[model samples]
Target: DKNEKIYVSYDSTNKNCKAGDIEMAEYGHPKNDVGAPIINYSIAYDMTNEKPLLYESYPGSIVDVSQLKYMLEKIRGYGYKKIGFILDRGYFSKANIQFMDSCDYDFVMMVKGRASFVHGLIMEHMGEFESKRACSIKAYRTYGMTVKAKLYADDETDRYFHIYYKAKKQASERARLEADLDRMEAEMDKIKG
Candidate 1:
């Protein structure tokens, strides 16, 4: 009913609960990074007003990805005529994307660097990218971090992928990958010893 642009962010928070005190509380990876009997409460917020739209609690063991279906349905029930969703990387998946597309919802989610298909696409188009500031927002960020974006239509899935590149992020990702490999090798040696 409102004319203002609608945006929502999906996220979760985990909290420790006492035994028999909170229903659906069980062991899962704690967002606090502490091993405890915690329950995760997944919440969606209307970004414009920052109001809570819907929330669902799951066992501590349930991963965030598995809860997207439940949360998506809750948002759809809100009956928003025109709205766009902004979700974090953890919520990105082919199945989730397909589901959202099937429901005819507009969403923006970042595909992870580890996704092989996205990686291949990036490699295929990396050379075609030329440095440019398309608009004011891009111009402002260009001094520190330059961005290049391209839109590609996927005929197989009937989906379109808008891939963005940041020079800083690309360099950092390479360094991070090398560090991870070194750390893994060290851990493996310790395990063998």
Candidate 2:
């Protein structure tokens, strides 16, 4: 069985450009202090084949989430059918969710941060699997991909969510918080001195 599942991931990246190199790009924040013109573009990547399916350029002045609608339509023009999208949490929104559903696309998007329901879910079930050894999983550069998932629905919207309990991810997140607190304390010490 050589048949492979078709999965596409949509992501946008910012690039440096000349002042008038692109028509739509403007002086937008590029997450850097570089005083140069920038351009933003979205690429639909075929994760199964490790190739890019479609790409759409955009004005650099726009944020990533703001370009989702345009990117969706641009890829649709490429005439790919029955393709599923795996998107990052940054693309989560009521409008985006509705748009994907309207387009009849199978989509699996990562949920970000605390929606009230997600928080409640965590509170309700996190204690059930609190040990690192219980859900220890190796993923990417960390042992943190182990997850327990549950289907969730938003009361205010029709969007359904899958909440995951990732122990290694949680550990990594706690390390990040510890780092931030360390930095803040160091700053306070410097100021006091």
Tell me the alpha-carbon RMSD of every candidate. 5.6, 4.9
- Backbone clash pairs in model 2 (N, Cα, C under 3 Å; residues 3+ apart or in different chains), count: 0
Candidate 1 residue-wise lDDT, 1-193, digit = tens: 5445678888887898766767677888776756568988877888888788777888888888788987877666766656678888878766777777777678877767557767776676665443544422364343222233332355244445655656776679899999999999999999994
Cα lDDT over the full model 2: 0.70
- What does candidate 1 score in Cα RMSD to the true structure? 5.6
Worst 10 residues of 1 by lDDT: 142-151
Worst 10 residues of 2 by lDDT: 140-149
Model 2 TM-score relative to the real fold: 0.68
Per-residue lDDT of 177 in model 2: 100
Q: Candidate 2: which stretches are off by over 4 Å?
A: 1-5, 18-21, 33-36, 132-193
